[model samples]
Target: MKLSILDQAPISSNQSPREALQESLKLAQAGENLGYTRYWIAEHHDLPGLACSAPEVMLGYIGSNTKKIRIGSGAVLLPHYKPYKVAEVYNMLATLFPNRIDVGIGRAPGGSAEATNALSDNFLQQVWNMPNSVQDLLYFLDNDIPTEHHHARVSASPIPLIPPIPWLLGTSKKSAILAAEKGLAYAFGQFMSDQDGGAIIKQYKDHFKPRKHNESPQVIVTVTAICAETSEKADEIALSSLVWGLQRKRGEETHGVPDIQDAKDYLRNEKDGLLDDMKKGMIIGNPQEVKKAFLTLQDQYNADEIMIVTITHSPLDKIQSYRLIAEEILK
Candidate 1:
């Protein structure tokens, strides 16, 4: 399986913007050395913890730093951005990076209502129209549809002769059907539990029809991966990072990741809801344990690619986790 890195660039307590960006670059460099196929940044707006609000700009930086690893959005949160603009940005990246840029698109806003409203006026409508809007965006990027014939036309300068590989990022069956119909690759989020990735992969492969851009179906699974010396250590590291997600679910708007002490204290006081959520879907363990779990997932889904998202309070810890996984499971 091909290994890739997915980063939300979570800002930890006492970390500045510059520090976060530098840390992300360090992680990207580490992934490159570890033989990862790609490094993807997630888009999340108006959130203090997530500094990857502008993935395209961040991708340009990542592209400049890494020599061989591919750089792109794990997802660009298509709903908030204009489809034409996204096509142009990704096309430019592909041109700059040649064969090393990927464009993974998703429907979610990756933020709360207040944040979404702050980013765009029509965020809700844009999200609702994503399935159709993305189709149009793909058409413009892949084919030269004339402006006169079509009411709207989007043209890019130094047009991307080589199209970026398209990936549909979702955690639902609806996304699977759309990906299959479009013959695009699908990446299932590891956080979701109601949807079975194996079933979706089967549906995608069975119903796939080749388009001009894609000749076959490709399935990728994105999982929360934290590999350390032992399962207990991995879990401890993961628990702290995961508290941010739990807080979000609880409608709390906090910026930056909490410290291990803070997370431990919070978990001790509150009910185990957050901890339960993490254990239910996450993969946190040592090399052997993680490998066993991942192998089962791969075997069940017959996944073509695996993207690992390592969430941590420290960049060094994050890089170490990914490094351990690459050295042991991926080797």
Candidate 2:
């Protein structure tokens, strides 16, 4: 099974956005050294603890610091941007990094309503036209815009010898069918989705139509997980994220990822059901246990790759979690 990373560049309560980004670089370098197949950074806007908003810029920085691991946007939130512009940005990255660039397209706003509106006009309309947008993006990437089309006279320039690859990213069957029909690679956000991922991936493969760049269906399952030397340690680390999530949902002003002691104190009076709801979404365990869970999930989804997203109050713990998992799985 192949393993990769999905990073949100999470900020700790004690840290700044700048620190979180530095950690992102550290984690990406660590992932490459640990034999991870890819390292994808998420794009989030006006989110308190998540640092990255422009993945294309971050990719350039990360690509310069790493040698081989594939780097990309976990999802670029394509609805907010023009297809040609997106293509040009990634094409420049591909020109710089060659075969190492991946453009993971998504339709979600990736931000609050106001933030979304600020980013683009008619975001809903753009989402409704996603199929056409994706087609145009692909055409721009390939420099294959139909001659009769209005933008055919223009081209996404500084194109690399080998183009950046496109992957459709989402958490639903609608996205699966879109990716299938477009003949693009599919990445399921299993970490965030409550839907039947197995059936969704099946839908993608079952309906996939081969295209020039992608001749077969490709699927990657992105999941949330935390691994450590001990299950107790793993759970403690995970609690920080849980508490932060609970606070966010309640519209509490979060300082950032709270310390473990703070997380414990906050959750002490909370219902077990609420905690269980949060815990159910994450895989928390020691190395051996995490390895087993990951393999099982891989089998369940028949995924081409398993991409893990881990966040914690301590950046060291976050990096160690990935290292522990890699030792077990990449071996």
Candidate 3:
């Protein structure tokens, strides 16, 4: 199984947003050195804990910092930007990096309602035209259009000798179907939803159609993994993410990812289904345990690639987690 990264630039306790951003580049460098296939960044806005809001800008910075690993947005909230602009920006990146770019588009606003409102003039209208927007993105990326089409002459330019690999981040059958229709690669965000990722991948494979714009069907599953020397330690690290989940559930964005003790204290008196919800998309254990869980995840999802998002409180532990996964499961 192939291993990749989906870094959210999470700000942990005693860490600043700038430090988190710096850690992202360091993590990418470690990912490349550890033999990870791709290092993808997440886009989140108005979130005090997440430092990366513009993935393309970070992509360039990460690309320059590393040599071989593919760098891109885990899912650039496509609804917030124009497809032409996305195509052009990524096209330029592809030209610079050649084969080491992956362009993953997603519908998530990557922000709250207020941030979403600020991102676009008509948020609901953009949501309505998402499918059409995706189509436009695909067309512009390939610089191909039906000769009879009205905008056949228009081209979103800086056409690269090698186009950035296009991927659609989906968590549902609807998303899978759209990827199938466009013939773009599919990446299921199991960490974002409670739905069955295996079923989603199954439907995507079953309904996949061929498009001249690309090659064979591709499927990637992005999930969270936190590993340490011991199961107890791993669980302690996992608390940070648990607190993050809790904050989101309460409609309050966390400041920086708190420490393990703080997280445990926050949830100590309160017990709900949040832990169960967190487990749906995460695995926390020692190296051997994490490897086994990831293997099972692979067998269930049958994905071509597995992208791991490890956002622990310590930058070193987060990097260590990725290294352990690469040394253990990915090997």
Best by TM-score: 2
Per-candidate clashes come to 0, 0, 0
lDDT of 2 at 90: 94
lDDT of model 1 at position 81: 75
Q: After superposition, how far is residue 246 of candidate 2 from its true place, in Å?
A: 0.8
User: What lDDT score goes with residue 28 in model 1?
Assistant: 92
CA RMSD (A), model 3: 1.8
* lDDT at position 2, candidate 1: 79
Candidate 1, residues 1-331, lDDT tens digits: the string is 6788888888887798778888999989999999988898988877767787788898889888889898888788888777778888888898898888888989887877898888788987887787887787677667566566452554744477688888888888888888888778788886554677788778888988787643877887888888889988888888777787788778787767877777887788777664775577788899888888888888888988788888888777788898888888668
Q: Ranking by lDDT, best first? A: 2, 3, 1
lDDT of each: 0.81, 0.93, 0.86
State TM-scores per candidate: 0.92, 0.98, 0.94
Q: Tens digit of lDDT per residue, candidate 3, span 153-201? A: 9887788988888899988989998898878889999887789878888
Q: For every candidate structure, what is the RMSD over all alpha carbons to the true structure, in angstroms?
A: 2.2, 1.0, 1.8
* Candidates in descending TM-score order: 2, 3, 1
Output candidate 2 Cα RMSD.
1.0
Q: Which structure is stronger by TM-score: 1 or 2?
A: 2
